[model samples]
Structure formats: structure tokens, C-alpha cells
Target: MSRSDEEDDDEDFQAESNAEEVSAAYKLFTHGAAGPITLGHLRRVAKELREDVPDEVLKDMIIEANGGVKGQEKDVGGVSLEDFESVMKRAGLSFG
Candidate 1:
């Protein structure tokens, strides 16, 4: 195959892998919930993982994921799967 074809194949593979990873992360964090993930969900997941992250830190995470807009942190509802994926990408975080 040509070099261009190889690059396309690699890109396709990476996309698929990223999708799978996002799905897995969503399930794990949301605990199979159908709705968006909230602060409660994150706290439960962190507790289950034996992590001792503080509530303020968790809130900060949500705020940061929601574009870090000043004075709007208190209005955050929850994070959808798409937003979660975007935040993870922007933060350079991955399930792998």
C-alpha cells in the first residue's frame, strides 16, 4: 500500500481506539448510568477506586471541564459523555 493509505489506516485505527477508550471510561465513571455524570457520580467512583480526592478539587475538575468560565462553576449541572471525552482530550488524559 502507498504511504498515504498507511497513514489513513493508522488514523482510522486511532479513532476507533479512542472511541472505545471513551466508552469504557464513561461506563466506569458513570457506573452504567444513562444520565450525565455529576459530582456525586465522581465522588462515588473516586471512593470506589480508593482515592481520597477532596470535594473542592472535584468541583474544580468539573468547572475546568466546563470551559473554566469564572462565576459559573456553581451552575454546572453535569457532564455528558461528549464533554467528558473533550475534557479528557484537552487535559491529555486517557484510560490507557
Candidate 2:
């Protein structure tokens, strides 16, 4: 039994969508982690995204996500889950 081309295309699209979701989660976590996530987590995710995003872009994202203050440190900086949701809504992203 073999699958059809349409099946393969559907599978590929689904896989790509899943990958995008993973990437989005990493981006969101890197930007909005309150405490459960750590520096190591951000470093790993940033390393993964390096192949796709430029270093300067990531720096800018970090700065923007951190409320315009650069390198405030996580202990003193973070977006609450409620606030994260609000920001996401403002940015046209939605959460279930």
C-alpha cells in the first residue's frame, strides 16, 4: 500500500505547521518567560533560530520583548502570562 501525492502534500503541510508552532513557542518563551524558563532555555532556542534569523534581529527582539530595556536580567524582568496574552492579542497572535 502506498500513499497518494495529495496525502504526502497534506502530511508535509502538517509537519511544517507543527514546526512553525514549535518555533513560535520558542520565540514567545524567549520573549515572555516569567520564571519557569531560564537563560539556558533562551540560549538554546536562539541557537536553533540562528540558522533562520540574524543575530541583530534576535537582539532587537530581545530588547523589544523586554520592554525597551536591554539586559535587565530575568530575575528582575518578565512578562506575566496575562500580560503576555494581552501583548499577543495586540500583536495579532492568539492563544487558546
Candidate 3:
């Protein structure tokens, strides 16, 4: 059994497609001019993309693309101690 000429073309096409995927992801994920910088930007992108995705899913994707933390990934039941400390510090109520 051997490969056909068309298989080689398909591989080349796939490689080009993969490169495009990376380019687009990098542009969007790195907060380029078109990325979400403020709540308004997020709202605008959400409005534009809502038809292709559910609200919750789109929100999560936007967060991930903006390099958001994955603090909620570990457990959905309760917050971690470190998370609580970070939140408190941000709120200017940290004990230490």
C-alpha cells in the first residue's frame, strides 16, 4: 500500500490551514487592535459573535483568549484560599 499524489496535496493544504489558525489565534489572543480591551469592546465582540456561539460559551472563550486565570477550573464548589486572599487584597481589605 502506498500514498497517492492527492494525499500529498491534502497534507500541504492542512499545513497552510494550521498556519492560518495560529496566526488568527495569536492576533485575537494577544489583545491586538481588534481584541477586547474594555467592557465595551467585549460587548461589541459578543454582539458580533453571538450568533455563532451561546452567551456563556462566548464569554468563557473571550476570557480565555484574553489570558484570564483558570482559578475556577479546579473546583466549582468553593473558592480556594489563595483566590480569597487575592480578592481581599484587590478590595483593600487584606489582613496581611
Best by lDDT: 1
Clashes per candidate (backbone, < 3 Å):
0, 0, 0
Q: How accurate is candidate 1 locally (lDDT)?
A: 0.76
Q: For model 2, which pairs clash?
A: none
Order the numbered candidates by TM-score, best leading: 1, 2, 3
Cα error, residue 76 of model 3, in Å, equals 15
Q: Over the stretch 43-96, how does candidate 1's per-residue lDDT look in tens digits?
A: 998899899999888878877765654344465566778778888777775433
**Which lDDT value does model 2 have at 83?**
42
The TM-score between candidate 3 and the true structure equals 0.31
Poorest stretch of ten by lDDT in candidate 1:
68-77
The TM-score values for the models, in the order shown, are 0.77, 0.37, 0.31
Error of 1 at 52 (Å): 1.9
lDDT of 2 by residue, 1-96 (tens): 357988877778876775566445645665644442333455566676775555455555544555654334534233334444445556765334
For model 1, the superposed segments whose C-alpha errors exceed 4 Å read 68-75, 93-96
Name the candidate that leads on TM-score. 1
State which candidate, 2 or 3, has the greater lDDT: 2
lDDT of 3 by residue, 1-96 (tens): 347778877777876765555445434533455422333444455566765445456456444433454434431122223433344345554232
Per-model lDDT: 0.76, 0.52, 0.46
